[model samples]
Target: MSDAGPKGRTGRRDEAAFAITPPQIVGPFYPIRERPDLATNLARPMGSAAEAQGQLIYVRGRVLTPSGKPVPHALIEIWQANAAGKYRHPSDMNPAPVDPNFKGFARLTADASGCYSFRTIKPGRYPTAEGEIRPPHIHLTVEGRFDRLVTQLYFAGEAENLADRWLNAAPHPDRLIVNLQEPPSHLEKHAMVADFDIILASG
Candidate 1:
């Protein structure tokens, strides 16, 4: 089959004609406790003044089918450790202090244009039970009407990416790594932004 050229063109093919996002194992720390109404901001709860401690960042992206069509109202859930490399779970014995302000879990839905955005601090690297170091990444579960993708988002140019077993396992690992940059003038100032578009097999 021929390629669909670039993403914004009008002559794109059907969803089954393109490659979909790769899948990843949902590591050990899926949140257990009841999730707060986190909405999009993991840095601070709505109406609260306290913020999670670390370098604040904005994560924004779209959920689309392989054909480049939007998957509106798709459910997106994310979880990660705090900036101290500690998870707010009962099983994580990492010894790092958990930030009370940061729950590290959020659930949101993509808009009509398949767009979603959230604010949070960058997670820290943590150790595995086998003594291997896991790089900083955000775990995500995106459920579309017909498909669900489980994956991890990695940072670009992180030294640990070279040694991470989970990351290297992906056939196209470069697709999962994103560069953090300065946000636009309309968004918040001083925080970095990472734009990651998720293409599902079908929606």
Candidate 2:
């Protein structure tokens, strides 16, 4: 019901707890437990392709063009690391318990003001090949009638942003960075406010 805001001060848990009733999505992309060791359990979800259930990371933002106008009806897709910093991909080898019910993928269609919100979790930091560590970030896929884009959003003030070899090593930092804003005093303690405006090409 609550979570620490972007500043991590604590209000409500900044995530969605799987309950019998909640707004759904293309969800259950990972598992919460291992069914039988060595099987690599697939615990995403066991229903008709329902709306997903992400971990409740409050991703509320406006999608705007370089001119600073919101793009209505923008389709946004996201993929992020599990709580343990491990991806569901075959390559991730962090050795953390992956949630079998999490699919790691979600989709949202933005509103008239180019605003969108996603309920996910604060992803964990993880390591990449060549011994390079990566900061906490979220991958975004955006599409509109006129433009389409794919990018990532990195936490603004994370120590990992400075220390991690991957972020610093990026050829173009603008392509994969996001600013985490402090929530209003009312929500200052409830949920984080990550303001990311999707940069789209000229229509």
Q: Judged by TM-score, which candidate is best?
A: 1
| lDDT on C-alpha atoms for all candidate structures | 0.88, 0.58
Q: Across residues 13-122, which tens digit of lDDT does each residue of candidate 2 receive?
A: 32222111111122222323333121111123344154223333466777776545678988876777866777776656778666665555556688898888765666
Give the range of the ten consecutive residues with the poorest summed lDDT in model 1.
6-15
Residue-level lDDT of model 1, residues 1-203, one tens digit each, is 54565543555544455467788999899987877464899989666569999989999999988777899989999999999999889989899998979888889999999999989899999999999998999999999999999999999988999999999999888888999999899877879999999989878
| After superposition, candidate 2 runs with Cα above 4 Å error | 1-56, 163-176, 179-190
TM-score of 1: 0.90
Tell me the TM-score of each prediction against the true structure: 0.90, 0.63
Clashing pairs in 1: none
Candidate 1: residue 55 Cα off by (Å): 1.0
Given candidate 2, what's the lDDT at residue 109? 83
Superposed model 1: Cα runs more than 4 Å off: 1-18, 36-38, 47-49
**Clash statistics: count for each candidate:** 0, 33
Cα RMSD of predicted structure 1 = 3.4
